[model samples]
Target: MMSEWLVYPALGVIAGIFAGLLGVGGGVVIVPILLFVFTTQGFPAHHMMQMALATSLGSIVFTSIASFMTHHRHGAVRWDIVMGISPGILIGSFSGTWLAAQLSTRALKIFFACFLYYVASTMLRNFKPKPSRQLPGPLGMNGVGVVIGVISSLVGIGGGSLSVPFMMLCNVPVHHAIGTSAAIGFPIAVAGTLGYVVNGLSIADLPTPHLGYLYIPALFGIALFSFFSAPFGAKLSHKTPVVTLKRIFAVFLMIIATRILWGAL
Candidate 1:
């Protein structure tokens, strides 16, 4: 038990550092780690995926804040984009949370496995830098935002994978796209966390130390350490080689996805 408690905080530090450095939603790491930890701790098999997703979303709340603040200070955030996406994200997140709650553990595991594979494949592709172009109009942006929110919330991710690609497709600079995606993660985290909390109210036999689906101990530990480490990640992002990092991340995601899929089957 003591060792498990120690591990949770250690997981937080590692997740935070990666989130900061890579701009990943942290789900890429947190969800798999939580699945391993919760399963090892004798959490009910059916509840493991739910707990993992909830814990991951909960951790992102703090990590996103730190990341957003860092990117904001660097003038990478596009306020207009955030505003355009906020409403759709709020609505979509709630819907996605409800959907996740209705899913059986087996289904959720398969879903996550597929999602991870998709993300990994995309990340493995080489991306060329592009110039920013004006989006068609409010309607188009809002349409994309809704999709991003729904998918991101359901997957327990920060929408960076989707949002960055969308921005890049729209001709936004890669740096600006990344920064804006980080900022957007804040609203997605807030909305998604609230949705999970509300949805978890109806679930019975949740593990101890839980509020809704969230494990308070895990949440507290992740938030505490990630808050400090995310800024460091932001600094590293500027200096790190992005293509190499993406390749490394892609390999990591592939391994995790295979493991999760195999475990589920």
Candidate 2:
């Protein structure tokens, strides 16, 4: 058996690459992987899924930082848009955690897997939205941000799937949209992580040394490698043909999602 020491860092490297390259939160994949790892570690089945969600978001806090900084250095992120939407993101993310806490573990797993399928299919399509208009006003962007934040918190993603499409629809180029999505993920991760932490604090029988629902060791292990690896992916985003890789990764998500769905049933 591979030790968690090895496994978690490996996961971080893989997730960080996906985060930087695709402008995704990497938690799209990280959540399910964490669930599997947590299961192996004998965590309470009752809280396993949410803990996975929380831990995934926690790791993304580190992943998004490095990823966005690299993207920012490349002049790909749109700071104006990130600033405009952040208020709404924080409000929505903070509330979404409470909503997540109310769901049963099985229900949450099913819902999470369904969302994963949606993310995978979107990637496989590689659909670029046709730009129909300029970016919305601050009020409109904030309204959209609320929706993105709520959904992101519920699903433990960094909001890339939603934000990237929204940016493209606003006439941003694909690269710019990806980078901007990475930036946007920062607020989502911060709020989502806090939400999960606060929501999980009252629960009992959890693994110790946790911050709310986050598994501390998993968080640290993933964060350490992701910090170094995200910059590499960010650089690759500018130089590589990420399309093929995204499709391959989408298929991987599909398989893992199916596994989750089966367990939920």
Candidate 3:
């Protein structure tokens, strides 16, 4: 239990830094590690994946806020873009959680692993859509938001992996896209977390000390450290070279994806 305590908090620190650095909401890191931890603790296999996803999204609620504020302080976030896409994000995110609840645990894990592979591949290739035009109008942005929200919620992420790239495609500067994605993460996390809470409510055999799918102790531990570390990460993002950070993150994601794929199979 003591080791669990230490490990969960340490995950938070890493998640926070990643969220600030990449605007990924930290769930890319959080979900896999939580799956391993919960499985090792002899948690029920049937519920473990959902629990991990729920807890990861729950932690992101706070982490996103911390990261967003830090980025905002540096004037990187684009408020207009955030406003344009948020409504669709909320709707799509909530719907995605409902969809996830209907899937088998193994199915969800496989899906998540595949999605991670896609993200890692994109990053590794440094694929950037050529800027062919200006940012999309409101309806187009909202449509894109829906895609980002649904994919993110299904995979227990903050939508940054998709949103950042989409923003870049729209000719938004990379740094501003990252900062805006941090802002976007808050809404994705909030809607997705609430959806998980609601969907998991009817499970009669949930493990102890949980709020719906969320494991309370792990949530607290992860959120606490992530909150403090996020600001530092945000500071570092301003100083670090973006390409270097993306390459490092891409490698990390590939490793995580491979591990998850093995587990799911």
Candidate-wise lDDT, in order = 0.80, 0.86, 0.87
Per-residue lDDT over 1-265 for candidate 2, one digit per residue giving the tens place of the 0 to 100 score? 3497898899989888877676566788688888888888899998898898888888888778877887899999989999999999998888888888898789988988899899889889987789998899989999999999889988888898899889999999988998898889889999999999999999988997788888888898888888888778878988887888889888988998899899889
Q: Write model 3 residue lDDT over 66-162, tens digit each, in one string.
A: 7788779999999999999999899889998898889888999999988888877787787877766788888888888888888888888888888
Among residues 3 or more apart in sequence or in different chains, the pairs in candidate 1 whose N, CA or C atoms overlap within 3 Å are none
Q: Is candidate 1 or candidate 3 better by lDDT?
A: 3
Residue-level lDDT for 36 in candidate 2: 86
Q: Order of all candidates by lDDT, from best down to worst?
A: 3, 2, 1
Model 3 regions lying over 4 Å from their true place? 21-24, 235-249
The digit string of per-residue lDDT tens for model 1 on 94-122 reads 77878888888888888898998987887
Cα-based TM-score, every candidate: 0.92, 0.93, 0.91
The clash number for model 2 is 0
